[model samples]
Target chain A: METNTKILACEYQYLESSELGQVLTWLEEYGEKAAVLAGGTDLLVKMKMGNLQPDCVIYIKKIAELDYIKDDADALRIGATTSLATIERNEVVKTYYSALYEAVRSMAAVSIRNMGTIGGNLGNASPAADTAPPLLVYDATLKLVSQQGERLVPLNEFFVGPSQSVLKPNEIIAEIIIPKLGPDSGSSFLKLGRVSADIAKINVAVYMLRSGSKCESCRIAFGSVAPTPIRVPQAEAMLNGKEINEELLGAAAQAGAAEIKPITDNRSTKAYRQKVSKVILQEALQAAWQRAGGAL
Target chain B: MERKWVKIKVNGKERQLYLKPNDLLLNVLRDELGLMGAKYGCGIGECGACTVLVNGRPMLSCLILAVTMDGQEITTVEGLGDYDQLHPLQQSFLDHGAIQCGFCTPGMLVTAKGLLDENPNPSEEEIRDYLRGNLCRCTGYTAIVKAVKEASKAV
Candidate 1:
């Protein structure tokens, strides 16, 4: 029997740093030559494919400070290296951030989730990343650290393009801060994939806040429909302050479909994505509205 | 790259080996330790043929650097059972005719062991969901699902 084994060709020094200062120093010294290894799910695969050949692979899993999920006064502070499984099993995340929970749960499968990290997910910056749309809907902020200092970047503005982010060579994502939802707010995430565990062809996340029978606020985000995960501000504007019903939802969905610029890929066609985006957005809106104590 | 010496527990046995920085756990288990049950179906993590248990959690051995896994407990399919003394899952797989070509069996068995250890009596849907990563081109999954269900009854 023939085996499909991968022999990583490049020779790189491996540095396992247990402290933030050590990581910063290594990053400062090596700069772009130093690649951070969080869970090794993305880095190792990229290395095997010869897409990335760095002089040094810095293993940051040993840094104890970068592996935690804490509930702050008004937000959840998640360490960048926290595993997807950890976030999926978090009670607070499951109860309050259902969109994130569903997105994390929908990522890959059990084994990959066990070995994949949220920091790596954001760092990889794939427009189709399952966690991006949900984070956009939650208004999540990412904290990046370097020898100079720390800075927070809004999740919406983090991704510049596919497999690209605004992160500098010296900076690393340290933490993710997600604000708590307001009262009577609910969120939902839906994705269309070739298989249950495959990468999403298109995904949508919706967060809605209800004030009596009218919509107080609504945020809609789509993934795999553009060069980056984008917020449908026009769609949100159409639904905000309007009494959310099937008619309003349909109109908003149409508006959202019109707003996104999807390209034809091997996984899906532009027409299929355009049609499915509206359907998914409608389903997500209905689910979020129902969760927010709305009848429909 | 410098070769580092590390100690890891494999199948309840401690092993110390000199490994390169890029040596994956999959190669160490197959070449160095001579445990070849875990097949390398996909070098990348898209396929679960390299699945193994690290500290009781299922992970792709191909993606894990052996140097970083020092002092961790590792469980491969060889630890489950042999032909003479079959584990309940192995026995169930045999009884339910879940083995076909047998390329993905080791990974499936190990992943199922991880699932059954966490949830002794899992529903059919839960079993299917947990085993979604382990792909078997044969068996069509009906018998595989039945074997897991049968193993759950005995476990």
Candidate 2:
């Protein structure tokens, strides 16, 4: 009775739940056997490729509760199922958080973004995820909820490796909280892919906070250059509280390049990534600096 | 295998379907509804050949589960036009010779219609950006772009 050639060869019982409490109970009961379906852009692909064979397909997108973006005093809290298109076009996100906007803008394509959710992007935990670099630069956090309750985790510690995250089988990402940028601060995200809307070969995002010509603080992160999208604390340290100039930024970029471990993959070579990592970091730094009203 | 009954509005008509858990919306649209407009190209979300409008937005039908689309409104290429009268975008595509293999036509038309519905008059760059998910390997993008531009005026 095997009707082969079915896109999803794995057989699973579809459990439809439109309530968050019910979804959490199912996740707790089914454990790893249950695969939560968010946007299906990533989950369905893995299932079709036979990479995952979950016995239960939990369709939680109908839970209307997990889809809102709220602005608070010092941070913006976004529900997990909020579509990338929504975030990309969000007025508050675009006006202030340009890096996050540009990051979403440079993702897969319009159709994908129309269905793709921020939760799925981080949940799948692709090292080259376009949303990662910018979210890293923004110092975002996640609220993972289970039947037992919820726990908060920083975005920095979320990823373990390729296609991995700290998410437990019974837990679901309920919310993403991104801290608001301070005064005189600006951020930029830059990605280079095979084409305009392709998986990133290498992507960099830089955030700068400056007081006149003095660099108060900065964060530089890159994707597709390591096992996990990472921040270059060494580079940020070099520019921290220092009057940024071209020479200093160039030195910091070089230092940042020395800190990463990029691999040779189909998207690019280790050598190419190693060389351009420094260049993009420098350019990102200069752009961030300029946006922060710094002279350089 | 057990099948679930679901209701969907296809091209303005209400349709009730019995679908399996693994049944994709693309397969259901093509096989059951006889809406051959959405093609199965990549089987994945990469190629735009299976694009369809779900709830007023262009989405990858290949990735969408037919079971999950209960009560959703879908628009395929069949919804666009007929032999006698064509949708402005369909006519424009023909006028500009935008069809090469004809595999990507349905996706292109549906996605373009979705774009125009949202923004009545989109810039050339906007059209190109919106159509990034719909791939035409025939190198007929210039003509496709021209067609979309011309249709924007008529739409």
Candidate 3:
């Protein structure tokens, strides 16, 4: 490959965990002037496109402590640097976060997943991010750390807009905390794309708690149909405590379809996406409901 | 900008080089080490033309930085076998009519080698999944799959 050397100097600073404190200190000193590199999947592309040019890149992949996937008492704490391929193949991830595993499998081909990190995907904050909807349904929280300290924020509130996140310039997403599913909880993710392995034109994730044949609590989230991954409270309210039925599913789907403001993009038409999104949401909810031990 | 010295073991031989700030593994292997078996079809990670074994794992050389590969065992298509004694996969590729223009053959062979190294006996589905990253414009993948299957028995 020909070197694109026309672009001026872009330096890489490799930092092990022992050097993390110094790196954080440097970021604190420089503030927005530096960029943290977890996985080069996204940052490298942006830098090549001339979209980003940080004075320095703080390479954090060498920090073994940051690549952990630990089981917290009430949740699964996934390190920000965890590769998407690892998440897809992990036994615990497949068992607890089935929707996330399924969603990740549907993302770009295996090569990209091997290099892309969950934190990089979230930090990239694309509207069509495959992992966002599943994470949103699980009520995942992000552990953002800086020189000052660490703070936890719900995943739904993480993305402010397309290509924008609530993360601070100097802070890094250290971990993702996914709350443990209750005994009767089940979840499912559904995505519609042009190809079998393409970014979703529309994606939906449903998390439901069942009591016999009834839904005790529910969360419904949608992606690529809005500016950010959207949690449909009105739709969830329609399904909460309700039994699975054609009418209820239709009502919930309609509610979710009514909340989104999709636009005509190169991927799919606005009208077509809006119409197909409702169908996908219904299918996703039914699957989640069935997994929760609810009767169809 | 400062340079980083990375010591890599290529095909069982250790070599050291001082890489520039943004030098990628693909550059070091092709330019510095003079191993041209790994072709550069796409600078981006989309194509598997630059696939090489980094510590025995098939990875896109275009995406890996030379500096991050310090003290790593690297294997290219050339490392597998030479023209005098072709690897089983190379022989199979020739026998099964797997190569057309031959631009994508080296990558396919290396990727197949990686898969077979871990799994000597793989199902048709498993073989397809492992080669999902490799794109072949010719032969429609039937010959490629057959070639991998044949190499499994030999290697």
Candidate 4:
């Protein structure tokens, strides 16, 4: 029954957990040797490329409690194993979290979205992850669970570096909580890729809250321009409580671009990213502003 | 690693097979079941040459672990039809000359079948968007899109 195809190497046990308790028990027993498989979109790719070879892969897609999208009193709670396609098709997500919806829609393709999960996107912690910028602008929080207990970490602090996160070996990302946007608040996500299906070269997400003719609050985030998805607090401070206009948006865009640290990579040059960051931020801001009931 | 017995429904028939934890669905389909219609262009999911229907949804078999797909319904190109009686999409592809190198035709046809299953009548733009995962270097997509459009009417 054996063929000459290059199969995944390394001895491993595939365990499917139907309950959170069973996953925790398995994690506690196997800990460092176990890799959690949610969608297997990224994990399998990495394993095929010989980049990762875990001794055990714990599949959590069977955990019923871990695949849900519920609207709580204050925010939307998305289970870690919930597929991107579910979020893209959900009426609530489409209406309330359009930035997330757009980002999810713009990800790989229809089939990948059907199999890839929001948790897998965040868990991979790629600087160019399409969901991170939108999640950051949404002020999302990640709930991490372990055998000991659960802890919630703000999305901004969850990432430490490229392909790294604060997640402990025995802990799993249980849910992502995205706060509901207040009235007169609008958000948008924009990504510049080499092709329609390629990964983003430079992406930006903007969230704006307007009051009358003034900007009450603003949050700007960029991807592929830093080690992790980051918010431009300096840019936010400049736009807060200020009258938003084309000239002001230009200034904010420059400030935001100057604040990011981008490195030249295979996808794009650092200079190109630094330049496009401003353009995409301005574009996102204008779109968000129009959505927030602002003119021009 | 110990081999585990997994039961799955391929096309319409129920099947039980012993598989390793890391065995891919693509390998199991082609090697074990002799379903050679699904090609192996890219071992990764980037290319849709290994596309198949998992629970009536288009998915890359290259990325799916066979053990994790237990009890799921799978459909490959071989399940569609034979030379005597071809599926409507297959007929349209042949009529429209959409098969060039033919390496990517199976993936394209399977993915198009999934799209038409979900959306009986799709606009040209919708067909392009849905089949963006399936890459065909031969036909430049014009004839394939036309074939899907023609098959939509027939189906």
Candidate 5:
């Protein structure tokens, strides 16, 4: 066929259970045999490509407990099924977590954002997921639910490899909790996609707490650089408790370029990603510094 | 193999039909309902050819299961306007010479309608950004962009 006109193979049985209790029961019953469908943007594409063919499809977007974003006692709680579009336009997210806001805004087109959910992006476990870099820097924690019980897992420990996570077959990500940052803190996200709204070849996110001219704390993360979206601790350590300056940012960028393990892929090559890693890191850190209210 | 009676409101009218669980919304609209406006350009969500407004927001119909849309409102290109009275965006598209091969017109019109409905008046950058997923290989998108901008004024 010139084009793959066939959309879905129509092989699996659709199981719609939007209630949290009902979905949990279905997950308990189907276990590995069931695939949860939230946004269906990624799952349907994989199914159409013959990469996945689960016996049962569990619809969770309508789950009452998993489609909101609001303030908890000490953290910002985001429901897994909340659409990216909703998060993008949220004033709290834009004002407080600029990196996450920018990440969601740069994710895809308007239609895809309207359909795709934050949970779907995390669950898909792609190294190129735009949400991961920002969330990692935000130190977000994911709440995974199953028939057994709910467990809180840090987003840092969530991804094990490409298209992989610590999630079991019966467990679903219910909510994401991001702890509030200090008022003096600021963050930024930068992405280099082939097009304005395409999968990123390289993405960077930086978060810092500004204490006068010195940076008291920092978090730096990169996507599409390694087996999974990873944090650059060594590079971040360079900026911690140091005076915010252009020279230190340059040094941190050099260290970051050496630390990240980029690979030659369809989107970019190891050499090219390495060559530009320093530049991307420098620009991203400078933006983050400026956002942190640093003059230099 | 599971069959269900799916109920959806399309073009201000309600439809109830027996369908397979895996039937895509695009297929249901085109094959079952005979709404040929939403094209099947790309089965994947990357291409916006199967774009349709579900519950007032643009969504790729091919990525959605028909049964999942039960009780939801779907507005296809057919819902916008008829031949008797073309939608403002449709007329602007025609006036701006936006229709080249016409494969991408239906999706462009509906997506542009969504932008205008939300923003009322979007800049050229906003118009282009909102329609990023909808592809037009024929006209290089300048005419389409102009058409959307012109429609913004008339609407």
Candidate 6:
């Protein structure tokens, strides 16, 4: 028998890891009736706002395997419970994926990063999730697990709508997989938030491979300006084998801006976000190109 | 719910508490154990005023569940050096005039302590990046960055 309680304006449930197997059974026993709690950064906020009142919160922090950073050949496996601070400091990510490092570095201040996890950010599926655009450019994949088994989903296909993900009730985001980069490849992440501490009004990520003075292959992604973190294929196609010139950048920026569909929110206006996104995208792409062995 | 007796080395003393099912680490430190050094600025983890050191890493107490810290060590603002002997970072904040209303000081100091502990030598940009979560309404962060650098030099 599960007992229910309330405290500090949020509904609460406490469960032990030993019982997780039972809880998973219970979740399957009562499908879509319970919610799993990881960092509780967003869930608790929603609870405080009276938006989410979960009948049961299966706390996953007690599961020891959920918190780690492991580097396998050709890819990095970041556990769902791994905090953003850990990612910001991990030498592997800093060396291999500078864009991700910068995104984690610029995310909500130190304390919030210390407690917030990358899996939680992705699970929340906000259009403004700072890491999503960068991860999209990297072609990152997500591994979600439930009692039945495990499944892998492309990061781009993970989100179906705002605040909605494909994760099932019993399933949990287990790990994030970032593929290895090839030669002449470099990445960059940039955001235009109200402050250094606030969420991104418009965030851009660029991944480029430079051959001589021209871009070999490139990917540009942006968040908070579309229904989801989207890839600007037109912008990317315009840059292929093209010299990094003001004319080419102007064309790509225009294409990138035209690809997004932004909405006005409390943090920024639709027009301002659409405008700033182009500038940020151009700058971030230029920076990334430079890092990929290209002269300014 | 299963209740467990959790032990933590808080400040200079060891504490054993039977935390309730819904008790947060911030509530346990403030309400149950009377460690007011860690404030409850925001219950939802936006504000950095509730930061404390969990195993030498800066963590938001509001987001940590008390029972989750079974054998972990915690350091609050009060844990850093006492009134008789102050930590260099504490002294630097005072000398640099980093305190405004004193509401954000303890949290700022604790956050800075974690940064300096990890990297005794941080650049100006690194210092700014490390303390990004801590918000101060008064000094705008020019002096806070200076204080962290000064404290690093002193230590």
Which candidate achieves the best DockQ against the true structure? Answer: 5
A47-148: candidate 6 lDDT, tens digit per residue: 655677666667676666878899888888898888898898899999979899999988888777777889999998899899999899999999988789
The reply for model 1, stretches above 4 Å from the true place, is A1-5
| Model 4 residue A50 lDDT score | 69
The TM-score between candidate 5 and the true structure equals 0.98
Kindly report which residue stretches of model 5 are placed more than 4 angstroms away from their true locations once superposed: A1-5
Top lDDT: which candidate number?
Answer: 1
The lowest-lDDT stretch of 10 consecutive residues in candidate 6 chain A is A1-10
Candidate 2 per-residue lDDT over residues B53-110, each given as its tens digit: 9988999999999999998999999988999999999999999999999999999999
DockQ of all candidate complexes: 0.77, 0.69, 0.42, 0.67, 0.79, 0.49
Query: Relative to the unseen true structure, what is the C-alpha lDDT of residue B121 in candidate 3, on a scale of 0 to 100?
Result: 97
Better of 3 and 4 by lDDT: 4
**Residue-level lDDT tens digits of model 3 in A1-296:** 33562232356554323365776787787678777776676777666556777777777777666787888789999988898977887888888777898899888766677778898899888988989999999999999988999999999999999988989887888899999998898899999988666778999999999988788899988999888988999999998888778779888999999888888899999999989988999989888888877776
lDDT per model, in order? 0.92, 0.91, 0.83, 0.90, 0.90, 0.83
- Could you tell me which residue pairs clash in candidate 4? none
Candidate 2: residue pairs that collide: none
Error of 3 at A196 (Å): 2.9
* Candidate 3 pairs with clashing backbones: none
Worst 10 residues of 5 chain A by lDDT: A1-10
TM-score of each: 0.97, 0.97, 0.92, 0.97, 0.98, 0.92
Candidate 1, A43-120: lDDT as tens digits: 988888778889999999889999999999889999999999999989999998989999998999899999899999
Q: After superposition, how far is residue A50 of candidate 1 from its true place, in Å?
A: 0.9
In model 4, the runs with Cα more than 4 Å from the true position are A1-6
Scored against the true structure, residue A115 in model 6 reaches a CA lDDT of 73
Q: Give residue B43's lDDT in candidate 5 (0 to 100).
A: 82
lDDT of 1 by residue, B72-109 (tens): 99999999887799899999999999998999999999
Residue B128 of model 2 has an lDDT of 96
Q: Which of the two candidates, 5 or 6, achieves a greater lDDT against the reference? A: 5
**Tens digit per residue, CA lDDT, model 4, A1-296:** 33322466556888996899999999999998899998888998787776777889999998889999999889999999999988998999898777898899889888898899999999999999999999999999999999999999999999999999999899999999999898898899999998888899988999999998788999988988999999999999999999989999989999999999999999999999998889889999999998898887
